[model samples]
Target: MLSTPNKQFSIEVTSDSTTVAPPLLSTTTKKLFIPPWKVPETKAPMVFPTCPPSCNKEMSRFNLDGSLKDLGSYGFWVEMCGKLFLFGRRFVNWEQNVEECCKIGMTPIDLELATDVKCINSLIGDDDYRNRFSRYYWTFGLRKTEEVVSSYYWCSSGANITRNWGSGGEPNYVKNASENCVRMEFGRATNMLYLLDSNCGLVSGLSCQGPIIPKTCDSPVCPVYTCRKRDALFKTLADKATKVLIDPSKSGIWVTNDTRLFMISYPSDTKTFVESLAACCAVGLKLLSLHQEVMYSILVGAFNNASIRGEKFWTAATDQGCKKNFGFCSTNRLVRDNARWASEQPDLSTSNGTCLAVSSDGLLHDELCNTKMRYVCEGRAQIPSLLDAVERECAAEFKLTRSEVKALFNSTPDELREKCFLKCYGEGTGLFIDGNLAMDSIFAAFQRITFDDTKRLLDMYSAMDYCTNSSKGMDECDKCGSLLNCGQENSPEEFEEFVETVQLTITESPLILPPVKGVCPEYECIKKPDQVKLLATAKNFTRFIGQAVVLPFVLQLTVVCNKKFYVFATNVERTLSRNLAFCCDRGYRMATIDTKEKYDCMVQNRITTFLNLPPGTTFAVGATRLGKLDRPSWCYSDTEFDFNLAEDFVSNDTLETNYGIAISFEPPLIMKAYETSLHVVCEK
Candidate 1:
């Protein structure tokens, strides 16, 4: 829905263009307040205590496989005396350095490490890294207030500072000025370090400490793979972007390592035809189609690997409200002749309706439109139109030239005009809100546009966080420019990958069918006085059943062969003796499956009702095993014993208890049990 910006536009001007009038007001604005140190007159110089002798102890460097491992995205990491110290290359203000450490999942060098001059010297005092470590380096130490000169404490641990003060009683607490942050300055002549109280806004190199964990190629914190901290902001975005993001391990979705994404909802979360469409739409996906055997096989394989057996998931294939031949709901493409089907499937009988469901065996089955069943959803990687629209709109509003816009991909503009342009772009894309970096919004937006290209999105997301953290303390306009610059300098591959993906045109797929007008199913529940009363009674009975049953928590009610059935299973486990009393409380008795027709109906519904139930879940029935395990007798004085029901249980003696007949949903069987607690199926 977004349009390209025009190359040129006309602006209204005065008819007599010979002379141009100057504006009445000055375009530049004056600063409301300025730091005392920045003033031309009365500027006080920074003071530091005398350099202390370096610690003479030999400090050993931490290593993995006889070599120091790369630990972070930026700054050189040195492991000494079982700790990781980061010598930052870029010089930034104190606050920016602190934010940088946090972005890399580290903290500013705390008091314990700062006091160890030997460890610090081992990292930056040597020739290999001396030039990169700037003159002043920031630490976690801070003075809480100027009123008390000794109020200094380590910001990371809140421990009081008793020693490690620079010579000359350094914390002078300069009058009429604030200097709360602490920094260590290198002495050029002595080749030693001196502690100084510096303004928080002063630029300095970063010195940070990380967790003592060893960094290896396979470790999450190892820079060799990808350096990123999965902070709270990332977790929040993941929760909100379930549809567009694929976290294969726990998201109930899978990818073919190419582009297509597939997912399924099962059992308790089943939906009807119209409800399924709405559910998929809510999550930015569409109902999946199994038009090819390979596609169907992949889903079946994933389900099998997940231990999902004997389940059916709805697909987009249907013949309703269209031509008589079965076709996909959206594309209207006829179902291929080779499409896998169950034996005697697509029975075009009016009773079966027209929709189709794919079973776990990779076969399709014709089902009714209103039948509730688990359904599959699908998505693919493609740039979202909403993001494209936002980019074009922001560029046009800021009036960025085509060349300037193109340059933004590989380099950040240094001019004021380009800085403001980046600010507009950041706000429009939700990377920044109210002039502050919003990592959560940025991640969500990226997931929405990239459609869960995990490899690219994660890399870019990490680079963006590093850039934003590195730009802390800058004015909003400059902050955007600095962030863009940092991104280009640090992670060029991510930017190139992003550009390549964004340039690809999205292939549109028809996701919804035309309105199914005037072809509603013939069955409809009409409101009538007596029928309404019956419905209310049924609702109360359903609620009562939940309270009367035992373990397995059965709450389903079905009617078969003119008999009303109630499955009673509460959250508790109860023995057969207790379940009998519970059934009587509801004015019903344990179910009797005497006839073969009733038995068949129960088995059919059992597959649907017990699809998600736990194994070893048993329900008490109306039969009793009076004989040995070889032969069993029925209940009600042992008058009727259906050999068919007991055929499979004759060889299993563990199920033979003093109680009576019970059915297990997992194995779909009838067995004898007494002492064992079980759920109940009552029929009146």
Candidate 2:
């Protein structure tokens, strides 16, 4: 095997003369000498020949033995400046191609400019190859070495070309940096050359350096280009849509199962709720429901470019006409199917004024009764008969009258009284009675009596009377000094018994009366003595009339006597011959005896005695007595006490008798003493 650079040839020397070399002259001898043939280094840098004067006009000519060979049609050639030139077109490894071109005294093609691209296209003589050459191609200016060295060296002019490294580059070996072989589009650096292992033997196009000949060319319509630009547009749109659709964080576009027709941003006036819902419906999407997932989806885009009231978005759920059923409705299936039944039987009475909208926080919310919001209208579903029946049953069971309810609850035990009160009256019950006299009275009465008695009494009174009477009775009970009956009648004995009861009970009850005038007379006189009466009489007095002026006329009287004083009667048949004699002592004087009046007017003319009498005083015998007295009589008997005048006559004999018989007469000494006392008192 003969390893030749750029060519693989096998030689067999069978004769002795082929094996034996011919004599060769030394370089120092002057005689003519021929150099021995030897293989050149395969990994060496490529050497290019000097250009002739007609180099741009014609192909370079080269001889077979390291000399310029003449251009020929049968030999491999390349074009130059639109002229046909002989150049190899057979496949060869990149290293061999570079050596072969160097042996033929030409440089491998290195494409850099547009003209260079055209030149390579012409040289390839195949459309596909020319197209690829214009885009990317390798050259012998770079080579491979040990350690997979990838480096290249300029061949045509020995200039270091370091631009346009495609993908794989960088030398692995020192020699590979000078190696005359390279692969195109395989480098770490773009627009540059790199080294590779010589054993790789990958084929590539050659590169050449020269002033490029211009060519008339048509504008490209389908120039080869990467699809990255178109791909980038698709990728951007997809990324945006995904963010909007599945954002757990709300910074970006929000989405829902149903598309929100418009994004209402603050500062941008948009359509009303109804109008927005209509717009969404035009595109075949409904407003979101209470389903959190679906609601989240629908409200995704809603907050994108709009101002919202709160975070919540408005849904089709409503409680306006649903006061009777104000709670979450179990219509999950309907909601999933985009259908909703009207709550409370669809009374559209105020439908025109209601609206729905989304809040800033992306939750569904409602606006004011008359506000215009972006509403999500929904289609109605039929109410299930079973649910309706259940509701009716509940309504029926809950019906109750106020009294029945009160009785049912009030019957509870004392332990439950507080709870029952709260249930019946709501909150504390003390305020119900505060400052209300009638209520307080009723409560007070209840405390005083048993519940049964209170109920009976309350029933007996009319509503108006109950209130007025209760208030009045409360007032009386507060002040009255008698036992209160609370408007209930008691037996006479029981009434008496109650009176004997303590004053506190009397004050608390309502039956007692207020104070008034008048007394029970049957018991008044027995306890009082200043009101007794008396009478005045004279002897033989059938008719009597007298007038006396008395000062201090309001004197109270009291009389005590044992016997009745008498007034005598006159005899009509005969008049007594004797005249009634009247007598007066020295201080007692009888003024006149009047037969018509039948009494002597006796006046005590004693000054001290008369002056000593109190004003309005009168002296009389018993008209009514302290013990007991009968009609007036003259005979005072049966242990009677009396005052009467006595008369007597007396005689006395003188003691000196002898001288003359003299005689003397005297009244009785007691009577004489009376007469003498009366005369002596009168003289004083």
Candidate 3:
């Protein structure tokens, strides 16, 4: 396999038998770069309407028609290379230029026009005119707040402005002067465009940009391809062997009877977690989710079969919220019973972030989300004939002729065509009900097209449903795309979830039409070592430092309190300080009992049996009358505990008492001295 020098992508070899080689001789670099500024002739200026009373700028600011409200109200409003732009004649502050553009129903020039500085500059015939208008101009790049430090966004599109800043290292905010707005300036020395963060109050010429005019078909009549024509075309294409199909076994990819196709990636072509997620989605799959032990074992066996062991492979288990609660991204539910953490794991240290990866031992370990790692992909293997039949029928219904539809699939689809195709497929597959995704129908469709195991189909439907539901209010086409996006892409949090640009792999792999019978490799489950529960003393506890932010821990507890679990380290003896340290060592917060409901629950239940403690023994809890308060408050985590339920306490308070207690078979919470030894209860 050959990868780019930057490792952004690699050539995918379908079969292990195939080999790829670099060119025997290096080719000459092509120097056919065309400068946008080299235009044949300058376009005529726009004619504007008369200026209104509200306008206070000079007469020259208005167009030749003597009006600022007209089309060319700014400088020279012209369409260049199919995009609309306005070059202003007068100097105006960033805010004023924004208002002026809004007055004309446009936004400040965006990155596209800003990059082609010479094109706009060349439009001016005279050097003086170019220096006056195109030399420097305000753009839509604006940083609204100082809190964000140094990121500017297009005010109109909200896209991050990431052009080559050139040598000046501009977005420096000019020695912290609060230069929160961006303007484009031409470097006379380099003849290149530079995006500089400038003060909003600075005056500069206006440069506004408008949307591109879409290409229109000249013929108004669109010839419809009826079902008869579609079938005939399909027969022709089938006879010619035009459609490329995937056969898993021949391609060295694994498929299981459980309705999941597992695509194993190798170390040579590793990608960051987010990029891996997108890579899988690009081909209609998701990062493998190990939520089920049986699935995990089967995948591990596949790893052994592929000779891809002894390395870390990224899984869908991640705390996408950045919270410590790790869950499978495919399902937003917490990873509780199935979480197999390595020793001292999920420490949330800078090195070990909130993302998860499975080692060769089949145990989950925390890894940075940005770290490059091999990943496994999981999805239902498609039957090529079924997919082709559906695609042909939809293309006919949408009037996307047989050739056009085939070409669209062969290449990367444009926005309009892709959306139209998605709409056709969504409806054709019965996945949509009244223009909305009907999640239940997904299972029915899966059962009809793929394997017919009820349990496996249900699991597949559940994952797809979660992803689709999260994108409910999006456009129909976007929703369809999002269903394919699944994991990190459709997560609730706003994140840099996708790669900056998607590179389309154009070369087609060899095709095999026949269905590959999937076989799961036999795997024997090995018993793993039990986690050692260690006792924490005041001296030894300080060795473990807390995370930068103390996120709520995910607890695995045996006792349930009001549907929430409270874990007790029964193996470790407890002292007021030792108990607190023990919970901290385990990344848990000591149990807090400030609410009346908690007090009542403990009072009603047999506390000794529930906690596996001796009867009449007093256990330590996370409560204290901090700083001369009349009643103690629960203050283990950053969360504030309610003290209004002080009246519900057993009227137990004393000057010597500094710690809270839960007595076995006792109803109300009582206080104990700092040195007091008692059983401890901890919560996440």
Candidate 4:
């Protein structure tokens, strides 16, 4: 096993990075080239991305409300303009596939409108989705009437886009062969044409198009709820930070609002974990030591509620630098516990597991101190570790030392071009991950890309697109899983001269990328948007990037897609005593969170907060405190909220900085407006 180091270090040598060879002789030439746009990239172009984890979870045939909830996560569920399309399972009969969709509440695709057909095909065509068996899927829209080719009509609508069919005569009927079914083939990265008629019993992929919103929140049903848009997701964090940073009128370094900073941790805004103990000692707050359930939940809720996805900052929980044998660095008194392990966690097999970082999943993972993960500093500023990481990728690929990379970054366009920037860009070609355009990361990759290589990359991608569409893999290129395995790395002998050339100039000044069409890639630096254009070349690059940058796409994809996971409503505001009466009188106890999943759900709805509500603000949850002096009993059940308490119901009465209130117990339902008049929401 490769063990990660606990100290910041520089790369002595690059990985088995591939060198670019002159293209294999082909009829294809430089006549074709597309511009590389600053957008999202993917291996296969599908309408909806490959279903995310939450969408792909193994669900039951029925939800709690007794509805079909088993939408195959393997397939794609797209809802567009009052139309629902399900590109369902492979190798299933047209009849069975349509029946499955109908059982879970959907009808087979009706390609009555040319646009509808285009949209469905766009999912396949744009995403370059192809059938594995090369077999087409069944569609109900096309049917044969007489033995004539012109006899076919759109089953759903009589008048339709007649010119929509592919070049190959569709609805082709052979001698006595039943052409009752319409099927279309989708190859990855290929522009699939119109549908064809085939035998009904023939096995093929399934795609069903119907209504936009399903009547039930069930399988074959993907509920897209009201969620933060791409731009709005990270806005809250920015607004709160701005308020604290700009307002000279306030001294709230750690503002405790409904959404901003919740707890005073070791240092989330600025410092790293190296001399972290001494740093925190200079101030007041120590590394976060979660001895109590309330502290843990508040922190977890704070982390989960943030719209930013996949991002994790360091907490002061570790066994390193402990005066006592096994405690946090800042507080030698705090002891370690095994209860928080997230199912086979704290991999004690490595010494580096001594450091810890908290994630939005409400659990802690062991990490090395020098993992290049971001951490909040004293009052502000993120630790400069991750920034240093971007610098490293630039240095290694460009064959430039640290100082040279810095000079290229700080230099003007003319200055960089003088340094042979275009050649450097060519050298860094084929560095992207499947040309995935999504570019949806908080950390910008230092994409040392140039004009010539960008065009080369695009050219190669277009050529591959041609090959896949033709179903004729390029010369010496097998139709592998997605794209070609035909790169310099795959066949190094062809690029031996290229490697020798790059290595020959190693000790002296290396060649930079040359200008193409009198322009360098990103010339004029129209925008120097941070460079996560390329991935980190470090070993910990994958692991470190794993913690914060990649999770947002997948982790938050399904997070916003559960509109059917109903959140009930109310504005009933009363004291704990009166709210309890209201709930009991209505045959419902206050809501209670019985599981970690429920806690996460509550956080998703923004129903749970760290804010201190006035006397009549918060709803009385199922959490019970028999006497004023008694420890609160958590884990109470509330049928209406469909929840049970998960922990202790202890909180500050006067709203101390350390002890703000959270329902602690999961209560189902309600949205509250931040008005002076209390708008209490209870389990409905």
Candidate 5:
């Protein structure tokens, strides 16, 4: 076994110092002049010091020799003081096995020389002590070579010996043969040891060399000062970093420290599933799979920087290019409000301008490529929020007011109101009235009013008329007849006689009735003015009267009348005059006669017969008669009467007397009596 060496020293004798020992010469019986002390030969083997007791325990536990008793079933072993000790039964590769030993406070053995191998072999004993000896096995120490050499060297044993042959033989690292890994082998040539290459990941035994140490792996490595230093460095580095720098042009796998996160920015705004995956690979970040924790870690890493612009970012998870795997994709973090899954087998022929993001909350969110954001990257999936986690967000996005809530009961329509409502509120909200939405308070109030009230209001300002009395029954007279029925008492014979005398005299000789000249002005009567006429005649003790009244009622009202008088011989004319005066007082105008031309000729002839005009006298009868006829006169004088009588005789030869001549000459007396009675009756 290798052992520690002792210190050695040497002594040299020189010529006797000047006269030194003279005092001691007496005993010179062959005592050579030598130094009082001589150096001794120290023989010690080249060995490291004995390891600490803790290290010795760890080394013993990981020993690989069969004599070493196993402590557990994991195939772990240790070596301490050149003795082998075992811990577990399971075999692991050299690197992994070494790591396991280290976890238990032991380190893999460094068998770089033959002495190390000999020392270990001696402690475990030789074949002489056992029924059969096990073949040498490969140790953790390995060699890397590009080609196979004629002689394979054992890094652990530090020799080219065949005693440690693998199951088949020693490895040949000859020229032109590349050897990149090392493996382990066990058993002898007869039994055949197992040989495994490093790259092949074959399982094998492991050994450790050190003091047997019992250490719990939970010991803290980073002191508080070291932690502060690391945190400061992280902050300083992060502050200066403007963007995550990844070289998409390079190709290789990469890993992130726990302090740093990995992210990938796609080269283009949009891409196919295949293209996106390729982009990720170019940046050394594999698209995530369905490992929840890893995915969550990746997302958290992405959002570590608070200065990220977009609230959400994307991840590479779409399986659009995958044929067999469907529904393998990332979900939107804001999906409760804006959730939508891509159409199955989205049309790749068209540009799908969508992008995926891994948000700071450790959730995946998708957005259009034009939207900018920060994102996270991971090797796998993560657990999403629980069902109730996003409820508030969803409610905020979809909440409705009372009016909108009521709309849930109505049917959709085709008009603008309905269309607008649908556009704003989506498909099925109920608030329609007659195909129009009662969306406003005013419109709702209007809809609630009764139809009758609406109609009345529409016609409120119209106007109409009402009748008090119809003109249908009002009396109307056709004409103004003679007003001759005034007297209540008159003999029928007298009345008859009066009427006959007036009619006969006026009809036969209107001129003899004495024309009432200027009764109305000629100019006034010429236009056939509407007139009323009155006739009065008297016989003894009786008077007759007839009157016609003309009433002209138009926009203005007027009345016209004519009155005439006729008398019997004594006092009758006077009685008639009284009646005429009464009629005149009742608004009557007298009728005029025009007989000047004919009557003037007759007057000249009568004058010639009665009395010749004096020799020089110019008898202008036409002038005189015209003058007399034009003047207003109630009665004719004697001369005017005689002339008028003679004129009448010459014109018609019928008027032979001015009055009833000598016939009934004695009637004057009776006539006078009748006239008196007539005057009295007329006066009454």
Candidate 6:
């Protein structure tokens, strides 16, 4: 517990990016000091190249002095400073060579550094093996927009070329030649590895070096990160609660509190729609049919209090077929009574979005029921009485547990109990923490944390403690003014459990492995610009291994409309607004699909959207709608729906069905949406 002193105490701690801890122990002064630590650095791993076996035919068997060489190992590879460089003599156009290297899982020659120029020259200068080329070897990743000097840049990707890598007075664009591609001329030349631009279409040798990429999902190599914290929490709860007991009348359901019931799916398994429903029925719980707001709030509050807060779970609510009347499978209640729809969701626009699920935000969404998902079965005991229980409860009980009690009274309250539990864990773990924390003296000293992690450790400890002792009555503990002396007035023991130990809610952020992109060299690097930018940003994240980008990566894509305009989808959640006032400084306005042909072209690409959300989850489109909601007209070119298009991306008919316009990946007739991902056709 805590010691009473004449003066107040404070802990001063400083730490590095990874962790924080206090160092000094001076109780008399009442000022605890902490030391700083530097994050340790580890050496980067050395990568090697494994070229395709068929590349052997491209190598020369003889040397200049008539000495024969294997020339195997993919047409002569050289290792320089840990990077494996593989040289190929496959004659092809510059762009084609780049794609070929990409297919083979490598990057085109990027002679960015002076050392690269020197090393490449040393490898190709061996007269003993150097005579393997025509007049020159292609080494391009850039194009010459003009014949002038300093006009060259790495196209396909917006990377600038390092200064002075080209040969002196070279890239001359000799004799009006289309010297858009760079090449290296072999030996007898004073300036070795001197780069010069040549015709991009000319056949020349290819050089590539980089990492491999697993493009498809479900590949073992595909980046995938799962949040195992959720499953682990449920498993631990089930293991410890084995003796806490389950009601036989309710079957497998765990009576978490006096009113609510819960049945977490087995740790090892998940179920689809039919399986989940049948499983719930067998257990007599019925997949948690939250018939009213009061019931929904009660379940969320109890779940938040009994740990495992802020995770996704399946609910009993579903439209099943985009039917206007969606009801609880086990009840006579409809969802409209206690609606909990996520932004632009419960999208009855598509039949596939039938099953309902709840996320940490407490929003219910319509998803495909057959989609395998973890679920719960909930029920309530028959308080078969002459009256409702909340009205009969004492004021003290309401104050002590207002979060749960409020729900019983049909009052919606923000999450409070879960936040209080988090505070307790923080108090249990650290003496020096952020913010102004006014807590009891006994609780302050219990901050000797030795657990590896607070997630499972706090929950496990709480379940084992079975917290029962409380010196303070429920009447005074719930008042904000009593926080300073919130705990029971009693002598502190060897260790004191946190006030909210009986109920805990430790949350873990979900991990999503990003789409994989291959590593490329800096010089003359040509590839998809968007993909290049994505890789560049991903490289900084060591934990994700260049595989994950924090959410909203799709916002960078821009569509070139009929090769005429860059279409930019504004980040409005639903229906682009014609509010140019938001971007008046940049003269940005909403785009209009007034022309049927223009809209058709954008639609042809099947650019899916996030249901026209205002949030910039993807690259923005420069478009908007104008006029009143009922009599709305397009604002493109400031005209009243006057443009004619060849084909419509989303017809006026579909707009009425959706209540707004948004591009989707699914083709004409019906709409399909990939969960959490949407396309924004931005033309800029």
Residues 348-375 of candidate 3: C-alpha lDDT, one tens digit per residue: 6552336788886677888888889888
| Residue 229 error, candidate 5, Å | 69
CA displacement after TM-score superposition, residue 213 of candidate 1 (Å): 4.1
lDDT of each: 0.51, 0.26, 0.46, 0.35, 0.28, 0.38
Clashes of 6: 39
User: How does residue 8 of candidate 1 score in lDDT?
Assistant: 17
Tell me the spans in candidate 2 whose CA falls farther than 4 Å from its real position.
Answer: 1-87, 93-99, 102-105, 111-138, 142-151, 168-180, 185-684
Whole-model alpha-carbon lDDT for candidate 5:
0.28
Residue-wise lDDT of candidate 6 within 1-684, one digit each (tens)? 111121121112222122345243442322222211111134221121111122211113334543324333234455674455656533345655554454443456666656777776675564323333223455544553443444555432334554544555545544534555565655433425656665565544456655332221110111112212222212211112111112333233244543345666644557775667666655445566654434555666655754655666677666644354566554423565337778887665554446677774567877776778777776543221101222222222334354554352232223444223223323222211221122211121122121122233223222222222112223322221122222222212222333222111111111111101110000110112233234334221121222223323223222346432222333234222222222211222334455656656655653334234343233223322211123324322323342133223323432322222333333332221111122334222
lDDT per residue (tens digit) for residues 281-398 in model 2: 3322343444322234334444554444444334544344333222112111112222232333333445323333445554433354344443432221111112222222222233
- Against the hidden reference, what TM-scores do the models get? 0.23, 0.17, 0.23, 0.27, 0.18, 0.22
- Give the best candidate by lDDT: 1
**How many residue-pair clashes does candidate 3 contain?**
3
Decide which is better by lDDT, 3 or 4. 3
Once model 1 is optimally superposed onto the true structure by TM-score, how far is the C-alpha of residue 408 displaced, in angstroms? 30
Instruction: Return the lDDT, model 2, position 425.
Output: 28
Off by over 4 Å in 1: 1-73, 113-115, 146-150, 213-684
Clashing pairs in 3: 49-67, 50-67, 51-67
Model 5 lDDT-worst window of ten: 461-470
Can you write out model 1's per-residue Cα lDDT over 508-602, one digit (the tens) per residue?
A: 32111111110011111111223223223663224333222222344556666566677755566555445554554344556767766776776
> For model 3, what is the C-alpha lDDT against the true structure?
0.46
Order by lDDT, highest first:
1, 3, 6, 4, 5, 2
Q: Higher lDDT: candidate 2 or 5?
A: 5
